[model samples]
Target: MMRSCLFFLVLLGCRTLAADDQPALRVMTFNIRYGTAPDGENHWLKRRELLADTIRQYQPDILGLQECLESQGEYLQEKLPEYAWHGLGRNRDGSSEMTAVFYRKDRFALLQLENFWLSETPDEPGSMGWDARITRMATRVRLYDRQTGRRFTLVNTHFDHVGEQAREQSVSVVVRKLSQCPPPSDEPVLLIGDFNAAAGQSAPYTAAISAGFQDAWVQAAERKGPSITFNGFKPVDPGADNRIDWILYRGNIEPLVCETVDRSENGRFPSDHFPIFALFRLP
Candidate 1:
């Protein structure tokens, strides 16, 4: 009898441990600068490998990429077979690139995928807004975690860096759309991408925060440096500042780790803007 009781206790402990070992979802956003340069080096082909390497290093479950062309998206998809991607083609003029979301296939199953332009009449798909700096779009997806049976929405976008009015209007449009999304649970909604707005006092930033979202950097305890993600191909200069790229979250989620990745391996930046990653727990 004693031996049987001991065996049962051991089995119970194993089940508890398995439940506690579930992995947290890792997400990252990167703006690859359409894989070009001002120096006229035309190093996208070479840099593509480096970009893939940097992403592979993190092994994020979901990755949001801005300024990606259809060809570039295909290249990344081929390189990272573990991930599945979704995005719309460039705008009518073939100028605005795709905003893509890549997810690890083994961990999460894709539930839904949709894209819409960030214009005054967003429902019309390709409509452009009044302020035309560059066409903007947002990609939304529903991902289900096979391990925990958790589901959430991930929205990725790129706002106009040049047109201040467009950026502000875009923020309102995005928030309204997200507010209406019906997720499986009150599970967290993650908004990731190149926001193109600096931290503090910016209208877009203020609007987003006021709309019940929190920046991951501010939630972190040891938040250090300028928090500027735009490195401009230079080695990360701590003093040179602008915090444009971001990862924001909503609902009952807590950020465990948040940091900007310096992909400046071997004195070369993977892109003009560094990527930001955040690890979160669903409570």
Candidate 2:
């Protein structure tokens, strides 16, 4: 009877361990604005430390950064050594650069890395789709959590701001790629970035949602303030409206906590756009 009781206690402990491993995962999306501003000040070098500090405060498991340049990416990696970074290289025009994903090394292991231009031939690198606007692309990464043994795919991108057609086309390309490489049966695909399009009525947002992705902010329990993302140094006040940045998810993962971070306390905006954060749980 003593041996049987001991065995039952061990089994119960194992089940408790498994349950503790499945805690909520925190994810964030921020458009760092290529470390530039209209005032001729605030370069990447000047704001690198501040950005890193703000990010570290949140301690996100995965962070998707849009409008990141190669130099800025290197700077971030150096400043935030706890995370691993991956993304596309710079473009010819030397602007509208790639989106990057920074995953916590101790928490998640990267399974695969893939990137593609958002064009007629999306498989082609640096291929421009419709319109004479700047080129756009998406970076996709598959990550496996060491603690829970759960895996998820994250796709980050920056849609064209000037070209409506290009933005729509870019959304379609991302949807196609995700469909082809769906996340595992038990995992989900989390899409986060600076879409440069508003939610609800915007074509790009509509296209992505139509493809079965749910917006984290919109689906929140309480419809908080306007989904405005681009504060642009304006005072954080009510009625400051815009919804360009987003965190969308598909599959078994559920977003438990969603909030738009107010970085104004830093006495500086991390980027032209505000960052969005979501805490998710896998069943």
Candidate 3:
């Protein structure tokens, strides 16, 4: 009887451990170039289906997209029924580019969604900051993972491509806004976007690191594909590292694998920039 009880106890513990160890969450960041851009052969209508196919193949649980115009966002929404998204155009009348966040409807529940500009007046919509060539914004979402019962925050942003100061200030603005969230700073947080600044070569990256966020690419035990995340609709050198898109995280998350997706269909590519994804587990 004593031996049977001991065996039962061990089995119960193992089951508990299995329950606690949830499957790794797939997170991706994509900068699908604005659909309206005049790219001759690389027009939006021409490659929309292929772009959608790439996303369908990966099936990320959470996705952050930059350079998404209103029409492009709507098209993606129609194509991907499994995901629920929140975003706003970066213009006062909502007619410009957007930084959007989309999450699997069945896997996560949306708790809160907020949009902010990267200016001194962050609360004001469509506000452009110092030295910025164009309006920039961020989409912040608080989510609840139904499978793991974990609450976390995700921030999707597009920093100004022309403004050096604006990019650095954008990081500071995001970090400050996060701090204002109701206590318990240790909650898992994910920041993903087209930063427009290469890692280790810009102030934005340095500021993020100073604020305690770890790059998922650096934290992953396994890495895959090329380091060049931007291709400009052309073939790129496999060894060159020119990544402007990134996934940074803090709190109780372990990055399992990081990959820069370098997939192209035939001679045509999906977008000007390649998508990056990381598989992470909440511990």
Candidate 4:
């Protein structure tokens, strides 16, 4: 199956998305496991190729990445030349892990991009909000789909992994930001990330839904593969309740399909979390 996926990637190398005609948008969210981790043999250098291969196989129109370090981003940029990415680290110096968003450059025109901390002092780059373990941020990009002449806002973020209050507030903060800069009803807004909280959880996930974003996996007509989106680099536990990553949308967007990519090179998965591949169309 892995071979088949690789074969498919080689055969279907990215083609130009014409400026006048695009049917749907493919989106993905992945926590690429920061390069600074001591994963021993499963380190970034050892797994970079497989990581890029995963993107190639999925061929997402836009990809949201969490916990990506500068070195890792450089490697991916070199490997995936067809895609363009935008984001800055959460650190004040912009030298640490970031919530990065990548898109097929030829498909979308980047109109504006901004990054805000998930804290009261949002303008302060390294401010940690509430009881959060570390500084976290959301990268917002306003993109124009030349093919469809559609404009939308895309947000990529990773909420606090440890702070209960921080996670809850993060969702509401994002919602407030979006509401302040409302988009037209037809063009959808997308937010994707490794949210650090499972679906239907009482905190931010609920807040996001209450604010009108639709969960891609939850709304999918067909769910392909395991329920556990985060496997911790182990074989998937059928009984594990590990769905934490998400691809969410608002506006007139419909989720046509959703899939969890579980491809592993040998016993080593690409990341601790499985990437989500979802197709969205404006209805």
Q: Pick by lDDT: which candidate is best?
A: 3
Rank ordering of all candidates by TM-score, starting from the highest: 3, 4, 1, 2
Give the Cα error of residue 82 in candidate 4, in Å.
0.8
Q: Model 3: runs farther than 4 Å from truth?
A: 1-21
lDDT of 3 by residue, 1-283 (tens): 0000011111111112224466568999999999999999999999999999899999999999999988898899899999988778888777788888889987777776778889988888778998999999998888777766677789899999999999999999998888766426778899999999998868999999998899999889999988889999888999898889999999889998999999888878899999999998767
Q: Which ten residues in a row have the lowest lDDT in candidate 3?
A: 1-10
| Residues forming the 10-long window of minimal summed lDDT in candidate 4 | 1-10
TM-score of each: 0.87, 0.86, 0.91, 0.90
Give a tens-digit lDDT track for model 2, residues 21-101. Answer: 666788999888775545444556566677778788888999999888777888888888999998765364434477889
Those runs of model 2 whose alpha carbons end farther than 4 Å from true positions after fitting are 1-22, 36-38, 90-96, 222-226
Estimate the overall C-alpha local distance difference test score of candidate 2.
0.76
- Report how far residue 122 has shifted in candidate 4, in Å: 1.1
The digit string of per-residue lDDT tens for model 1 on 1-283 reads: 0000011111111112124574477889999878544545426775778888889998888999999987888899988999988777547544448889999877677766667678887756566776757678888877776656677788899988788888888888887776566664467788888888997779888988988778988885445435789877776667766789888988777887888887666777778888888877766
Pairing residues by index, what is the TM-score of model 2? Answer: 0.86
- The lDDT-based order of candidates, best leading, equals 3, 4, 1, 2
Candidates 3 and 4: which is better by TM-score? Answer: 3
Off by over 4 Å in 4: 1-22
- Residue pairs with clashing backbones, model 1: none
Instruction: Tell me the deviation in Å of residue 103 in model 2.
Output: 0.2
Per-residue alpha-carbon lDDT of model 4 for 1-283, expressed as tens digits? 0000011111112444435454688899999999989998878878879999999988988888999987888789899988898768888888798888898887776766778889987767788999899999998877777656677688899998899999999987787777666678766899889788888766788999988888888897878767778887888877666678888998878898998888897887888889988987654
